[model samples]
Target: MKANETIIVEEQLSAPISVVWDAITNLNSMKKWFFNNIPSFKSEVGFKTQFNVKSEERNFLHLWEIIEVVPSKKIVYNWKYAEYSGNSLVYFELFENINNTTKIKLTCKITESFSDDIPEFKTESCRGGWNYFIKQNLKNYLENS
Candidate 1:
Protein backbone atom coordinates (compact mmCIF):
# COMPACT_ATOMS: atom_id res chain seq x y z
CA MET A 1 0.00 0.00 0.00
CA LYS A 2 1.14 3.51 -0.66
CA ALA A 3 2.12 5.74 2.18
CA ASN A 4 -0.84 7.58 3.76
CA GLU A 5 -3.46 5.39 2.12
CA THR A 6 -6.44 4.98 4.40
CA ILE A 7 -9.21 2.43 4.66
CA ILE A 8 -12.19 2.73 6.97
CA VAL A 9 -14.96 0.38 8.03
CA GLU A 10 -17.78 1.35 10.34
CA GLU A 11 -20.45 -0.79 11.89
CA GLN A 12 -23.31 -0.18 14.27
CA LEU A 13 -23.41 -3.04 16.73
CA SER A 14 -26.23 -4.23 18.91
CA ALA A 15 -24.22 -3.67 22.07
CA PRO A 16 -23.24 -0.91 24.43
CA ILE A 17 -20.16 1.21 24.01
CA SER A 18 -18.66 -0.36 27.12
CA VAL A 19 -19.11 -3.81 25.66
CA VAL A 20 -17.61 -2.73 22.38
CA TRP A 21 -14.74 -1.15 24.22
CA ASP A 22 -14.12 -4.37 26.08
CA ALA A 23 -14.24 -6.35 22.88
CA ILE A 24 -11.44 -4.22 21.50
CA THR A 25 -9.43 -3.56 24.63
CA ASN A 26 -9.81 -6.78 26.58
CA LEU A 27 -7.35 -9.51 25.58
CA ASN A 28 -9.78 -12.40 26.04
CA SER A 29 -12.50 -10.71 24.04
CA MET A 30 -10.03 -9.81 21.34
CA LYS A 31 -8.82 -13.39 21.06
CA LYS A 32 -12.42 -14.51 20.60
CA TRP A 33 -12.95 -12.46 17.45
CA PHE A 34 -9.79 -10.62 16.47
CA PHE A 35 -6.58 -12.63 16.67
CA ASN A 36 -6.40 -15.86 18.58
CA ASN A 37 -2.61 -15.88 18.89
CA ILE A 38 -2.32 -12.55 20.59
CA PRO A 39 -0.16 -13.61 23.50
CA SER A 40 -0.77 -10.49 25.58
CA PHE A 41 -2.29 -7.08 25.25
CA LYS A 42 -2.79 -3.92 27.32
CA SER A 43 -4.62 -0.72 26.52
CA GLU A 44 -1.90 1.46 27.98
CA VAL A 45 0.08 3.66 25.64
CA GLY A 46 3.49 2.32 24.60
CA PHE A 47 2.49 -1.27 25.30
CA LYS A 48 3.72 -3.53 22.51
CA THR A 49 2.94 -7.01 21.28
CA GLN A 50 3.94 -9.34 18.48
CA PHE A 51 2.32 -12.38 16.94
CA ASN A 52 2.41 -14.43 13.78
CA VAL A 53 -0.56 -14.82 11.45
CA LYS A 54 -0.39 -17.28 8.62
CA SER A 55 -2.46 -16.39 5.57
CA GLU A 56 -2.56 -18.53 2.48
CA GLU A 57 1.14 -19.39 2.09
CA ARG A 58 2.71 -16.49 3.93
CA ASN A 59 3.49 -15.83 7.54
CA PHE A 60 3.07 -12.27 8.71
CA LEU A 61 4.85 -11.36 11.89
CA HIS A 62 2.40 -8.78 13.18
CA LEU A 63 3.68 -6.00 15.40
CA TRP A 64 1.63 -3.48 17.27
CA GLU A 65 2.19 -0.77 19.84
CA ILE A 66 -0.57 1.07 21.62
CA ILE A 67 -0.27 4.77 20.92
CA GLU A 68 -3.29 6.26 22.66
CA VAL A 69 -6.48 5.36 24.48
CA VAL A 70 -9.59 7.09 25.65
CA PRO A 71 -11.33 4.48 27.72
CA SER A 72 -14.60 3.60 25.95
CA LYS A 73 -14.36 6.28 23.32
CA LYS A 74 -11.25 5.71 21.22
CA ILE A 75 -8.03 3.77 20.84
CA VAL A 76 -5.14 4.24 18.46
CA TYR A 77 -2.21 2.01 17.67
CA ASN A 78 0.69 1.57 15.32
CA TRP A 79 0.54 -1.65 13.33
CA LYS A 80 3.28 -3.16 11.17
CA TYR A 81 4.87 -6.39 10.09
CA ALA A 82 8.39 -7.48 10.99
CA GLU A 83 8.98 -8.94 7.55
CA TYR A 84 7.47 -6.04 5.64
CA SER A 85 8.49 -2.46 5.05
CA GLY A 86 5.60 -0.32 6.21
CA ASN A 87 3.87 1.44 9.06
CA SER A 88 0.17 1.84 9.64
CA LEU A 89 -1.82 3.68 12.24
CA VAL A 90 -5.14 2.22 13.26
CA TYR A 91 -7.85 4.21 14.99
CA PHE A 92 -10.90 2.74 16.62
CA GLU A 93 -13.66 5.08 17.69
CA LEU A 94 -16.85 4.15 19.46
CA PHE A 95 -20.12 5.99 19.98
CA GLU A 96 -23.17 5.02 21.97
CA ASN A 97 -26.47 5.47 20.19
CA ILE A 98 -30.09 4.81 21.12
CA ASN A 99 -31.32 1.40 22.25
CA ASN A 100 -27.80 0.32 23.24
CA THR A 101 -26.46 0.27 19.70
CA THR A 102 -22.87 1.34 19.40
CA LYS A 103 -21.21 2.80 16.35
CA ILE A 104 -17.71 1.44 15.81
CA LYS A 105 -15.48 3.14 13.31
CA LEU A 106 -12.11 1.70 12.35
CA THR A 107 -9.64 3.62 10.27
CA CYS A 108 -6.32 2.26 9.04
CA LYS A 109 -3.90 4.64 7.42
CA ILE A 110 -0.70 3.47 5.84
CA THR A 111 1.84 5.88 7.20
CA GLU A 112 4.63 4.33 5.15
CA SER A 113 4.72 2.29 1.97
CA PHE A 114 4.18 -1.44 2.34
CA SER A 115 5.75 -4.10 0.19
CA ASP A 116 3.53 -4.16 -2.89
CA ASP A 117 4.29 -7.72 -3.92
CA ILE A 118 2.12 -9.30 -1.26
CA PRO A 119 -1.48 -9.68 -2.36
CA GLU A 120 -2.72 -9.10 1.19
CA PHE A 121 -1.04 -5.72 1.21
CA LYS A 122 -3.18 -4.38 -1.59
CA THR A 123 -5.70 -1.66 -0.80
CA GLU A 124 -8.72 -3.78 -1.59
CA SER A 125 -7.35 -6.63 0.43
CA CYS A 126 -6.84 -4.41 3.44
CA ARG A 127 -10.28 -2.88 3.04
CA GLY A 128 -11.97 -6.26 2.78
CA GLY A 129 -10.06 -7.53 5.79
CA TRP A 130 -11.15 -4.61 7.92
CA ASN A 131 -14.74 -4.97 6.80
CA TYR A 132 -14.72 -8.64 7.69
CA PHE A 133 -13.22 -8.03 11.12
CA ILE A 134 -15.47 -5.11 12.03
CA LYS A 135 -18.78 -5.59 10.21
CA GLN A 136 -18.89 -9.39 10.18
CA ASN A 137 -16.57 -11.00 12.73
CA LEU A 138 -16.87 -8.45 15.49
CA LYS A 139 -20.49 -7.68 14.74
CA ASN A 140 -21.57 -11.30 14.88
CA TYR A 141 -19.46 -11.85 17.96
CA LEU A 142 -20.90 -8.89 19.84
CA GLU A 143 -24.46 -9.77 18.89
CA ASN A 144 -24.18 -13.44 19.70
CA SER A 145 -21.89 -13.30 22.70
Candidate 2:
Protein backbone atom coordinates (compact mmCIF):
# COMPACT_ATOMS: atom_id res chain seq x y z
CA MET A 1 0.00 0.00 0.00
CA LYS A 2 2.80 2.33 0.80
CA ALA A 3 4.68 4.09 -1.95
CA ASN A 4 8.06 2.81 -0.80
CA GLU A 5 7.79 -0.62 0.77
CA THR A 6 10.41 -3.31 1.08
CA ILE A 7 9.81 -7.03 0.87
CA ILE A 8 12.50 -9.02 2.61
CA VAL A 9 12.88 -12.78 2.46
CA GLU A 10 15.62 -14.72 4.21
CA GLU A 11 16.56 -18.36 4.01
CA GLN A 12 19.39 -20.44 5.41
CA LEU A 13 20.75 -22.70 2.71
CA SER A 14 22.75 -25.82 3.50
CA ALA A 15 25.55 -24.75 1.19
CA PRO A 16 28.51 -22.44 1.17
CA ILE A 17 28.43 -18.79 0.12
CA SER A 18 30.14 -19.50 -3.15
CA VAL A 19 27.55 -22.00 -4.20
CA VAL A 20 24.71 -19.73 -3.30
CA TRP A 21 26.35 -16.81 -5.01
CA ASP A 22 26.88 -18.86 -8.11
CA ALA A 23 23.26 -19.85 -8.16
CA ILE A 24 22.25 -16.22 -7.95
CA THR A 25 24.78 -14.69 -10.27
CA ASN A 26 25.32 -17.37 -12.83
CA LEU A 27 22.82 -17.29 -15.69
CA ASN A 28 22.85 -21.02 -16.20
CA SER A 29 22.07 -21.76 -12.56
CA MET A 30 19.47 -18.98 -12.39
CA LYS A 31 17.44 -20.50 -15.20
CA LYS A 32 16.91 -23.65 -13.11
CA TRP A 33 15.18 -21.73 -10.33
CA PHE A 34 14.73 -18.07 -11.12
CA PHE A 35 13.40 -16.79 -14.44
CA ASN A 36 13.83 -19.65 -16.83
CA ASN A 37 13.82 -17.36 -19.84
CA ILE A 38 16.19 -14.69 -18.65
CA PRO A 39 17.82 -13.83 -21.97
CA SER A 40 21.09 -12.71 -20.42
CA PHE A 41 22.59 -11.49 -17.17
CA LYS A 42 25.89 -10.10 -16.01
CA SER A 43 27.25 -9.25 -12.56
CA GLU A 44 28.96 -6.09 -13.73
CA VAL A 45 27.41 -2.77 -12.75
CA GLY A 46 25.28 -1.16 -15.49
CA PHE A 47 24.66 -4.49 -17.16
CA LYS A 48 21.04 -4.90 -18.28
CA THR A 49 18.67 -7.67 -19.22
CA GLN A 50 15.03 -8.14 -20.02
CA PHE A 51 12.58 -11.00 -19.97
CA ASN A 52 8.88 -11.60 -20.26
CA VAL A 53 6.87 -13.33 -17.56
CA LYS A 54 3.30 -14.34 -18.21
CA SER A 55 0.87 -14.09 -15.33
CA GLU A 56 -2.89 -14.38 -15.55
CA GLU A 57 -2.84 -14.07 -19.32
CA ARG A 58 -0.88 -10.84 -19.14
CA ASN A 59 2.72 -10.58 -20.19
CA PHE A 60 5.03 -8.50 -18.08
CA LEU A 61 8.29 -7.34 -19.52
CA HIS A 62 10.76 -7.47 -16.69
CA LEU A 63 13.51 -4.90 -17.09
CA TRP A 64 16.53 -5.32 -14.89
CA GLU A 65 19.78 -3.42 -14.65
CA ILE A 66 22.62 -4.44 -12.42
CA ILE A 67 23.51 -1.65 -10.03
CA GLU A 68 26.09 -3.14 -7.74
CA VAL A 69 27.94 -6.36 -7.13
CA VAL A 70 30.12 -7.48 -4.26
CA PRO A 71 31.60 -10.81 -5.18
CA SER A 72 30.23 -13.67 -3.10
CA LYS A 73 28.45 -11.24 -0.86
CA LYS A 74 25.82 -9.05 -2.51
CA ILE A 75 24.22 -8.08 -5.80
CA VAL A 76 21.74 -5.28 -6.35
CA TYR A 77 19.64 -4.55 -9.40
CA ASN A 78 17.10 -2.02 -10.51
CA TRP A 79 13.97 -3.94 -11.39
CA LYS A 80 11.03 -2.58 -13.28
CA TYR A 81 8.32 -3.65 -15.65
CA ALA A 82 8.05 -2.19 -19.10
CA GLU A 83 4.27 -2.11 -18.83
CA TYR A 84 4.30 -0.28 -15.52
CA SER A 85 5.45 3.10 -14.32
CA GLY A 86 7.00 1.99 -11.06
CA ASN A 87 10.48 0.66 -10.37
CA SER A 88 12.15 -1.28 -7.57
CA LEU A 89 15.50 -2.47 -6.33
CA VAL A 90 16.16 -6.15 -5.81
CA TYR A 91 19.05 -7.04 -3.54
CA PHE A 92 20.52 -10.46 -2.86
CA GLU A 93 22.86 -10.77 0.09
CA LEU A 94 24.73 -13.86 1.18
CA PHE A 95 26.07 -14.32 4.66
CA GLU A 96 28.34 -17.16 5.66
CA ASN A 97 26.68 -19.05 8.45
CA ILE A 98 28.05 -21.70 10.72
CA ASN A 99 28.73 -25.26 9.65
CA ASN A 100 29.10 -24.42 5.97
CA THR A 101 25.58 -23.01 5.77
CA THR A 102 24.85 -19.77 4.01
CA LYS A 103 22.15 -17.29 4.85
CA ILE A 104 20.56 -15.58 1.85
CA LYS A 105 18.55 -12.43 2.22
CA LEU A 106 16.45 -11.11 -0.63
CA THR A 107 15.16 -7.59 -0.36
CA CYS A 108 12.82 -6.06 -2.89
CA LYS A 109 12.40 -2.38 -2.29
CA ILE A 110 9.68 -0.52 -4.15
CA THR A 111 11.34 2.69 -5.20
CA GLU A 112 8.22 3.90 -7.02
CA SER A 113 4.65 2.79 -6.82
CA PHE A 114 2.68 1.44 -9.72
CA SER A 115 -1.03 1.75 -10.31
CA ASP A 116 -3.14 0.06 -7.65
CA ASP A 117 -5.38 -1.49 -10.27
CA ILE A 118 -2.65 -3.97 -11.12
CA PRO A 119 -2.85 -6.73 -8.56
CA GLU A 120 0.55 -8.14 -9.37
CA PHE A 121 2.17 -4.83 -8.53
CA LYS A 122 0.83 -4.86 -5.01
CA THR A 123 3.27 -5.23 -2.15
CA GLU A 124 1.54 -8.36 -0.92
CA SER A 125 1.98 -10.06 -4.27
CA CYS A 126 5.60 -8.98 -4.47
CA ARG A 127 6.27 -10.33 -0.99
CA GLY A 128 4.57 -13.60 -1.78
CA GLY A 129 6.56 -14.01 -5.00
CA TRP A 130 9.86 -13.44 -3.24
CA ASN A 131 8.89 -15.79 -0.42
CA TYR A 132 8.07 -18.52 -2.91
CA PHE A 133 11.36 -18.06 -4.74
CA ILE A 134 13.72 -17.75 -1.78
CA LYS A 135 11.91 -20.02 0.66
CA GLN A 136 10.68 -22.75 -1.63
CA ASN A 137 12.24 -22.65 -5.08
CA LEU A 138 15.80 -21.60 -4.29
CA LYS A 139 15.82 -23.52 -1.04
CA ASN A 140 14.87 -26.74 -2.78
CA TYR A 141 17.34 -26.23 -5.58
CA LEU A 142 20.28 -25.63 -3.24
CA GLU A 143 19.49 -28.42 -0.80
CA ASN A 144 18.64 -30.99 -3.44
CA SER A 145 21.40 -30.18 -5.87
Displacement of the residue 37 alpha carbon in candidate 1, Å: 0.6
lDDT of 1 by residue, 1-145 (tens): 8997999899999999999999999999999999999999999999999999999889999999999999999999999999889999999999999998899999999999998899999999999999999999999999899
- The positional error of residue 89 in candidate 2, measured at the CA in angstroms, is 0.5
TM-score, candidate 1, is 0.98
Give TM per candidate: 0.98, 0.97
List the global CA lDDT of all models.
0.95, 0.91
| Model 2 agreement with the true structure over 11-116: per-residue lDDT tens digits | 9999999999999999999999998999999999999999999998888999999999999999999999898788888999999999999999999888888778
Stretch of 10 with least lDDT, candidate 1:
4-13
| Candidate 2: Cα lDDT at 132 | 90
